[model samples]
Target: MNGQKLLIVEDDLGLQRQLRWAYDGYDVVGAHDRASAIDAVRAEEPAVVTLDLGLPPDPDGTSEGFATLAQILQLKPDTKVIVASGHGARESALNAIGAGAWDFYAKPIDIDALGLIVSRAFHVHALEAENRRLATPATTAFAGLITAAPEMLKVTRMIERVAAADVSVMLLGASGTGKEVLARGLHEASGRKGAFVAINCAAIPETLLESELFGHEKGAFTGAVKTIEGKIEQADGGTLFLDEIGDVPLSLQVKLLRFLQERVIERIGGRRAIAIDTRIVCATHRDIDAMVAAQSFREDLYYRLAEIVVRIPGLAERPGDAALLARHFLHRHAKAMGRPVTGLSADALAVIDGWGWAGNVRELENRMKRAVIMADGKLVTAADLDLESGGAPEPINLKAVREIADRKAIRHALARAEGNISNTAKLLGISRPTLYDLLKSYDLHA
Candidate 1:
């Protein structure tokens, strides 16, 4: 706390001195207006800021103060800004929070209560900063998988385990979920001598997909001028990644099954059978189970190909990952595009975390690339990303929304209470049992 800098954005000199001296442990800094506030933020990099929503040229209103708050947060997202409002404190507080202020206080400041809020804000800010720093774990060479989300971590562990075994593996997830990336990771991990071969069963028509997967001899067809080896034989002793395997034509499924079972392929119009020892890794966004039920896919082939199945959670399921991945993408693209942009604004990070990311990693990659190229400021804003800051509304399920709200409230109280359960319960105006139930329901550690 000694080194934790505090920025006071009060235009009034008496109040500024009073507030600065009141917080003895903090390294206090001052900014009298919107411009200075943003300057102090860039220069001092304060961890917390107490801002009065009344500053000149608009001291009679909060417009200037609101602008200052936005700019300060844009420079440093993790800096917790506590807003002070004399007029309509309650409504202003809510609006400030919506605008990304950490907390709000009323005028005629009770120094002690405001101090408590400041302390709580700093403590939570530290916790979150540490969480972000430690989120990424040391994993194997998965170059494309950029995540620290627990669900993705589990998938990574599964990939590592299955890749070591040299058996048929199936990956299931929504489109743009980085299936090909994981397939490449599997190939890198498999320690095979041959090349990593890939073929999208869905992209190619059924008439040509079979020949693509299983080779054809010379004069096998009108276009077959020379004896060509297919993806399977090309892989030889490496890995064969079959993307969108669910789209493999039923007529070709039998041949794939034979290759998996017999470890040999019969080239079209060829008498001799060639053997290969390629590890098969297949992925599909389609529900192969439903296809098997409809007889669109062969059940026997599905079983043969799916010696091990790994389900990759969609981007929505991997909470707390979007911002982390966004940071990575921003850094990578900024360097590649020769941009001076180094970070994202608070509003940009807020929108990224709250967005649904329907197209998953692919969409994120595109947005970040565009943002890096278009960004004019040192930090990327929501405008740069071409994204709406207003997030999608929550589902109309009262129970779900209530639980979400309760969990958030409980977590806030816990942060204020400094991890003391009894204090948290008291702060939340709830019994210990109720608090315990919430913690359990939300799978919170404490």
Candidate 2:
């Protein structure tokens, strides 16, 4: 387990030392004044903080301390703050709690009792943090796929079932629907001991396509100074993913078909045939059937490559998946950029669910990355997501409106509970019965 951090905000040096020594069990950090305290809170982001109610400019009053507490919470509302007051005990304690402190302690310093309270505060904080992390929508299951839509779930299940079989698999989906990710997952599940190699047929030049798949001997071409293995040979004992396989030139299709049927390849300059034991997984956004009818793509190769076909649904077809993936991307990008983003706002989520994600998961990820960098507030809003800023507000249909409402309620409940259903219902001012009704209606559950 990682050591918990404890921030003590106190001006008294001698008392700071005593408190610091007392909390030696923790990774204790100190701040002597309100300014340093705020800075420390921003920098260290401690899970628990101890604040002294009597501070500098108004050392005899609780004004500075109260202001500090408010700022700390504004910066990180999840931080557990325990206020210390040497003044009127009842009044100070009540006031501190009112200002959003986790707990309050009367001072004349009972070290043991204070230690117990601090420990309890840490425990509560840890539990709340853990609950939030687990309840986060992004971490939920999709068989390594980050989607919440039933259509996508069905696709994922199909992929999972097919991965165990050693058949040539073809993934049919629109661009940016994570075809390669699914392909990699199939490779991993197949228990293949070699590398998973991928090549985009459309991205490579036709003249060099054969050399790329079947390699070339030294001096075979002008740049061919040394013999290099192609994608097929490199994936000898694993899976080879051919992305945009529909784009392969008709000339190379025969060679690819030969390799598939014979399990062997001949280098461009070398006459000897080299045998390979590689599984083929192919993906294409294009309609290969049409291409074959037009005599553009080889029908024979198409038949060999598509032994078991899996169709991935577009983002718009997957209900609530856009928002789910958006939050996931936000968390990832925020941490990578070292930004302190808690979550998306209600308006942001509503916009996410309502919008038609034409570009799918990849588009959502890019938008979230931009939003995380540009957002000036702790929580991202629809404006930050670029969904509400420039575009004219589109009229919503009743079904769309219901989806928005359902998503909002579920997300709000999860947030309030930090993902605990009972607590979330209580926060929503409803009984667990009403919560269950809503969850069922929305097709959502804890």
Candidate 3:
């Protein structure tokens, strides 16, 4: 295990010395009061913290201690906070847990037991942090495509397979679903010698669109003094990605179809047919079949371009993928910005899983980037991602209410058995069949 930094937030100097000595394995930092504790948290940014509820200015009450806890969480939400209260152990522990503390301990501090709890908290914190890192979207092969859904996986596999071939490839997906990244990946995989050129058919005007694709000869027209090579010629021996190909004008479509069929291009105002070697990849979020039906797009050109078609799945279709992508983006942006972001909280992960990401992977990436930059604490919370905190705690219907109870029971049993359902049921004084039923009801596997 990696040696982690630990902060002890006790006002008693003697107890601080004892705790620090006991946790010799940890890089222990001590803070006797609220000001010092907050300072320690900011400066050290420790992964796990031990907080004493009896603090200065309100040493007998939990007011100051709870305030410190709230501040620490607000600043660095990822830190594992373990609260210690001498006066009212049960109340303090429960209150702390409700307020988002990781775990709590009663005091006349059992040094060994507290040490074990602290160690366990640290282990859990580290594991969660690692999970978040692994789940982060930026770590995946594709830059912004976030999905673990089998349908999306099939599309990715298709892209991978077709990328090795020299055939014309087309991508179909909804807007903001990251077709361009897939296009770029195809270019990278093709082993092309020249640059991967890109042009958006819908973004550029029709007047300049022709000039954008096919080069103009010197004095080809007014303001064409110098010879200029279009995107196709520039991408010779490489890939030319045409985005929003459905919007290409009829005139340009004929020219493009001719080039695809003959492998030759006639630059504007030039007589010679220039033999060019360039791969073509096109993408459109629109339904090409409908466009072809409407006679807005050339059917012949569509058939020629879409020799291999890949369809990308939207974000909501992928189960567990949004959380994975969120974590990935957080790690990347945090590292790039030099922030001490540990990972997303459990609630945050749940929110990510539940959200309907209509804007797809692009939206998820943007949210994570912003959350990582703005996060004051080590862990990103649901609130940081603009998700509801604790995520609809109360179930409205009987079915949902039962499901919630079942989920809670299964989670508790799993925890008690250290994630072994068989052992957990035995501990819960329940049969394996009953446990399995509970698991199924809650949509929980383990």
C-alpha lDDT values of all predictions: 0.82, 0.83, 0.81
Which residue pairs come into collision in candidate 3?
75-376, 75-377, 76-377, 77-377, 78-379, 135-324, 136-327, 136-328, 137-325, 137-328
For each of the candidates, give the backbone clash count. 0, 0, 10
Relative to the true structure, candidate 2 reaches a TM of: 0.61
Q: Using Cα atoms with residue i matched to residue i, what is each candidate's TM-score against the true structure? A: 0.59, 0.61, 0.56
> Residue by residue across 236-280, what tens digits does model 1's lDDT show?
989999999998877788888888888999898899989889899
lDDT of 3 at 415: 36
Candidate 2 wrong stretches, greater than 4 Å: 1-143, 388-432, 438-444
Candidate 3, residue 14: CA error in Å?
90
Clashes of 3: 10
| Superior by lDDT: candidate 1 or candidate 3 | 1
Write the residue-wise lDDT of candidate 3 on 1-446 in tens digits.
24699999999899999999999899999999999998888777788999998899888888888999998897778889999967556787789989989998887889889989998988898788766544433123543555544456667767878887989999998876778888988888778888899999999999999988998899999999988899999999999999999999998999999999999998888898998999999999899999999999999999999999888778765555676677678889999999999788766766776678878888888989988977889999888899653223333345656665555545444533434678878856789999888765444545
Candidate 3 regions exceeding 4 Å error are 1-147, 387-446
